[model samples]
Target chain A: MEQRRKERIDRGVKVRSDSIYALMSWRELSYLTVPRLLLIIGMLILPLVVTSMYWQRVISIVCIYALLALSFDFLAHYTGLVSLGGAFFIGVGGYLTAIFNTTFGLPPLVSIPLATVFGAIICTVLLLPCLPLRGVYFAIVTLMYPLVFARIIEAMDILGGTDGIMGIDSFSNRWIEQYLVIIVVLLLLFGLRRLVNLDLGLIFRAVKDNDQAVRASGMSITNYKALAVLIASGMGCLGGACIVHIYMWTGLSLFALDFSILPIAATVIGGAGTLVGPVLGCLILVPISELLREFGTLRIVFYSIILVGFIVFRSEGIMVYGQRKYHQFERWIKV
Target chain B: MNKEPILQVRDVTKAFGGILALNRVSFDLYEGDILGIIGPNGSGKTTLVNSITGFIKLTSGKVMFRGKDITGRPAHKIADMGITRTFQIMRPYYSMLAYKNLVIPLFSPRAKRTGGWRGGGKLGDRDTVSIDILEEIGFERDSYVPYKLASTLPTGYLKRLELARCLALKPEMILCDEVFSGLSMSEIASMIPLIERLQMSGITLIMIEHRLRELFKVANRVMVLNFGEKLIEGLPEEVIADARVKEAYFGSEEAKEVMDHA
Candidate 1:
């Protein structure tokens, strides 16, 4: 009887798994259909249409900012941990790469990844102590990271004190830098989606939904939360490394609350947990923010209003709302 | 049919600061038997389940599972060792669909690591088991609507979803805390057949419920508790006839009427 029970259970698991695989295969095939293929092909060739250097510069800045927002969304939506120190890892990456390129005589290529890794490791370890905390307590503790980092950098003579690290080398070719930024943004988009779709990602979501349920299933809640923070910091650090290379300097100004809030705002505005939310948020907010930069002192105010508007109206953000709208349109067309 | 007990609890006690939740509780679960525990509100039935599942630290005594002392093993680790449980308040992931809730257990680290997937005979192929269990519980195989979002589900569906997820683990023993509470008569009746099927599948179950009629019908043996101590453990008919059991039930006039009718 026991043997028969085991055999029946095994067969049940196999059939369900086969069905899930079939669903994924169907999704993949549909994604590659004629109109979808054309749309994807058009998107891939968009940059070639623009000949102006001015457009290139604007696009690069937008990509970098979007990267920052995407990382924040990964933490907030995927793991259900609201961390306010979004810029801390970015600041570390930028500052470290700048310092390495200028003082240590390193190429931008070598310095960027190294700086990102260094920043990621530091933040990952530092965030470990706060893993046991939850809710606003976790958020408040992490919020102090950027503030404390800024104070320490300012007080230290080696980091040029309050003046910050500066005069780092820009990319040798401007076009190369622009393409590099776009590529990084695309990679982050792909990576974020892949992470959310993985078994580990599902575990993180399970933790978010019900920590006690996750624990009873024989998984460590603390470990999973810590891992989420680590991955978020890693993405932030990578974006920061690229931004430093594009702008050629890093300062305490880059690590401010505005930088931190930008990602949170973008993530919220775009849609928190959905695959395309942060990227869409960045696509919309980054261009507007870049345009409003001409307004000087009023730029932050304008961004804040936009963010508040997003929060007040579409609380789930752009992607979620857009997805529903898209579905409605499809249904209407079908009818 | 006599066999050695698979689980033995010796003088187990738990206290929250100064208040005693369980006092010198001792019981045994047989290798392959359905045990029913019935009690009034706050009689420490759930507390006993919690202690066995390692959700709470015991103030005194030890619990041995499969002859190995497993006192204070932590909830997840205890679950890892082939003992799974459900809450009095159901805990299905609200954002996930009904089927996806079952997937969590099927992919549970303990279940997966124990050879539940390839059937190295470690955890014992939980994924395939879960799908079959879902079918047995009367969940439609082709219907994807039920797997959409748990938060949108009716109360009856939620209870079944919780049970389906627990069954996904293919546990050696299942500790169900008040599985029938808050469920409608129809809902309770539907679950009876599923419970019967699970028994037929050779899974040992320990259910705590307030529904005495269902308990009496389903359980081969019944245990009653009052004020954190075991009042009686015997065949349901014998326990119902006990004077102590009737006295405990007499605390409520409605229960007295029900007892007289019985």
Candidate 2:
């Protein structure tokens, strides 16, 4: 009996030790999945493998937009709130970065984070009041923020108004621009993923399931929801700042409804809840949109059809569906 | 007999707009005692539980837990103060599996509902406590798999899972809201032993149950509510025998039928 009890105690200690190892391994796996790091390595190496600047630019823009869509996904999927003002933050980050960089002579590195901070502050102010409402009310309230943002930017001549921000400095080398944009994208992707897997993410999901339940658990649901929106908006703003760095222009057109709606639509199409889903959706859809530019008016029509197709057939979005399919495949392989 | 009560309610009242959900009511939850609360559909049993658990703001009166005034503290805060509750609706995280659903509350700082081994997802300090509780509650390591998808479980397992989730929070007291309302006879039978064991372990419990036989067998004291008012508070035998309690619950012959069935 003594020997058995001793063995039991030993087993218990081993079990706990094993779990600690598992938890650490899970965290390490998450860091490796960073999108920007993967993108950087891919961009640096792909030049040697493929040697096309146009494709590189195309991939770069696709990735930059992917970060924005991923941010929107974090809000819509994780928190269960939809916002149409993603572009509002994106525009805010880009224009502020432009003003700081061109007008005030701030370095790109400092100015970009500062621009995102400004966007986050603005988003928090907007998100706080809108939190009390649910469902379509939230959608309508958030939709208005972008419309108002565009009109405000258009009215301000210092922001370059309808013509947008031009004479923005680009990096001396295209390679630096490519690498910098890739780095930021990867950082936001991995950083946000880590944040989501933390305590805040669980609380956020708790709020998503039942606000009353989270309250019952002794947590304030509203605080976490607002935090999620602010974080997502901040990331969206950062993505916007990156966009301006590459394109070298901040315009009223940058904050258009398409900018707001497309990211959300792409997030939904990519798989709204999972981290990789929106990124993959961005990769797939942005290229399609660019390719359809030759179709002019017909591009919008085609986009609508694609949106409808995803809604009808792949309701969880392409990335989620693909993820589930892959998981199922893995399960089969194991069997 | 002279020991200070762990929980004290002094003429507490709650209103949903113009509707009086709970009238001026008073009760005590003594340390290490199982208190049974029973009422009809509109008898304000859930309302009383909600008010105590901080789901609904009380219109009037005061609730003191551990000699501290906890009148308007939020549900999570109240839970953190060694008070946890399970829902009549039993809101399980549907997207997550049973183990993951259980782990949510286990890993969460506010996991105070039921005790059981909350297996590996993310184990914090609270989760370590949850694991200990899970083991105490007779949840095997294999049972952790059920948490993978909580919504798919049989009703019996769901109740067990919720009970485990609550216990993981390490509450000094638990308020169970209709825990056995919708369960097979075997399920309820399985649950009674768990509750009995918790009571043995010296955890104070306030159970609002319609299952009179189980409530009578388990509760140290019984409190009956009628139309938002406390009709009687007494020992189980006395409360069960009381004519007023019978009238409030089942109107003579109907109550006799209930008694005969039990």
Best of the candidates, DockQ: 1
* Candidate 2 C-alpha error for residue A68, in Å: 1.6
True contacts kept of each: 0.62, 0.45
TM-score of 2: 0.84
Give the fraction of native contacts in model 1. 0.62
**Model 1, residue A227: displacement in angstroms?**
2.8
- Give per-residue CA lDDT, model 2, range A47-96, as digits (tens): 34645777777777776677778777777767878777777777878888
Q: What's the distance in Å from true for residue B182, model 1?
A: 2.8
Query: By summed lDDT, which 10 consecutive residues of candidate 1 chain A come out lowest?
Result: A1-10
Q: Which pairs of residues have clashing backbones in candidate 1?
A: A9-B128, A9-B129, A12-B128, A13-B127, A13-B128, B114-B123, B116-B125
lDDT over C-alpha atoms for residue A175 of model 1: 66
- What is the RMSD, in Å, between candidate 1 and the native fold over all Cα? 8.3
| DockQ (CA atoms), all models | 0.45, 0.34
Off by over 4 Å in 1: A1-58, A96-106, A156-160, A166-169, A313-316, A330-335, B1-4, B114-130, B142-148, B249-252, B260-262
